[model samples]
Target: MKAFFSALSTLTVLPVPRRFHQCDEKSLAASVVYFPVVGLFVGVLLVGLLYFLKAIFPPLVLAAVLLFVLVMLTGALHLDGVADLADGLGAGGAPERMLAVMKESQVGAFGVIALVLVLLLKFSLFFEIIDKGRWLDFVLMTLLSRWAMALAAFLGKYPRVAGTGLAFIGKISLA
Candidate 1:
């Protein structure tokens, strides 16, 4: 009877207990969830804004709105990554030194150029789809781009820090 009660109690509760870390598991999970929500909102908002632009201005205006929306939605986090990674990789140093370069807050020419190109490409591609008069394309692009970001963390090694990135994703699972 006691064993039955114990099993019932375990099954009734949360399966994965919350964990705390320098970066807590719950907080990280929340961030992961939050990004997609923001992306969805951004995607919808951009499409609507583009629709408005199509009425009031040129199609090129849609690209500007989309670029601005991305900056707003990500708080430019991935843009920061692009900048950091560019500088680090472009430094032409050993791995340790390269990682150290990336850790610095200073932005360099390569970083700026990389960020500009990334934003440009995203905006241009998004603009093309929007111009085709398809609203569903916006939602699909948002899902695909965000999923690609999530995969980026999985496919790469933990740069210089331990326990960084989609906290719940395991190396073997990704492999």
Candidate 2:
């Protein structure tokens, strides 16, 4: 039971290879399914925060607060990955070059643009939800986005040069 919950916990965030060393490719795919569940928690928290502030503030302000909370909670990990991916894709280089660009620590113009756009979109979506006073969409988006991230990772070829994600790839099964 404990193990089940632990595995479920990791699936919500980026899975660390160190913790799931024994997971084979097949189980990896199965494990990936839980990310949406993780998103539920994220959405719940955000909604709860919004709810608490609803009496004191407007939806727009609550939306901003929730967004800030999300960034802090997730540590902006996915946003960073999105930025890195945008930088790599925008480089107009070979796959190897693109991979290299992604590996770099610095954020480029593409990364900046991507981050801004994604944040804006997310903020707008959340604002809409808050405006309507619906929490369901918030939870759904969180889960769907994580699932989308996992799908993107699963479908794409793993870039060469081992990193944190490489081990995750090895453990992940495509099913």
Candidate 3:
């Protein structure tokens, strides 16, 4: 239970007791298992927000608000990853140089472009899904994307000797 709570706390902006955020081998392991579960919770919240606001706001306004809520709720964790990955890929040098670029706190041209394209894709996709009346598709896709994050963690190697991702680098399993 503590592990699940830890995962929820780490993944969402939902108020979690500070004590539950403690990092330990046990909680780290449990958090991976709960990663998708966190996404499911997020997706449900998004779906609810969409329906509630759909009747009150124009589609464009609602889409903007929905995007804001998601980015805020998740604290842009995945967005940060996208930016880092973009920097690493776009650095166009030795692997170490790319890694260093990713580690840098500043966003590069590639990072900005990547983030913009991703957000634009999301915005247009949301518009189409709403037009087609496919709310369930949105929720399911959200769940699937988060699950992919867990998969990536399981398969990924740590770029640096130590960092936030080290916790999951060699310490994950499908089970």
The digit string of per-residue lDDT tens for model 1 on 59-159 reads 57766776776566545756787898899999977999988888888999889999889888887876777677776788777766665655554565665
Model 3: number of clashes? 0
Regions more than 4 Å wrong, model 2:
1-31, 153-156, 173-175
Candidate 2, residues 49-145: lDDT per residue as tens digits?
A: 7768899988888778888888877878778889999999999778889988998999999999999999999789878998987888888888787
As a whole number from 0 to 100, the lDDT of residue 66 in candidate 1 is 67
Each model's lDDT comes to 0.61, 0.73, 0.82
Model 3 Cα displacement at 161 (Å)? Answer: 0.9
Per-residue lDDT for 100 in model 1?
85
Q: What clash pairs does model 2 have?
A: 25-173
Better of 1 and 3 by TM-score: 3
Best by TM-score: 3
Ranking by lDDT: 3, 2, 1
Lowest-scoring 10 consecutive residues by lDDT in candidate 3?
A: 21-30
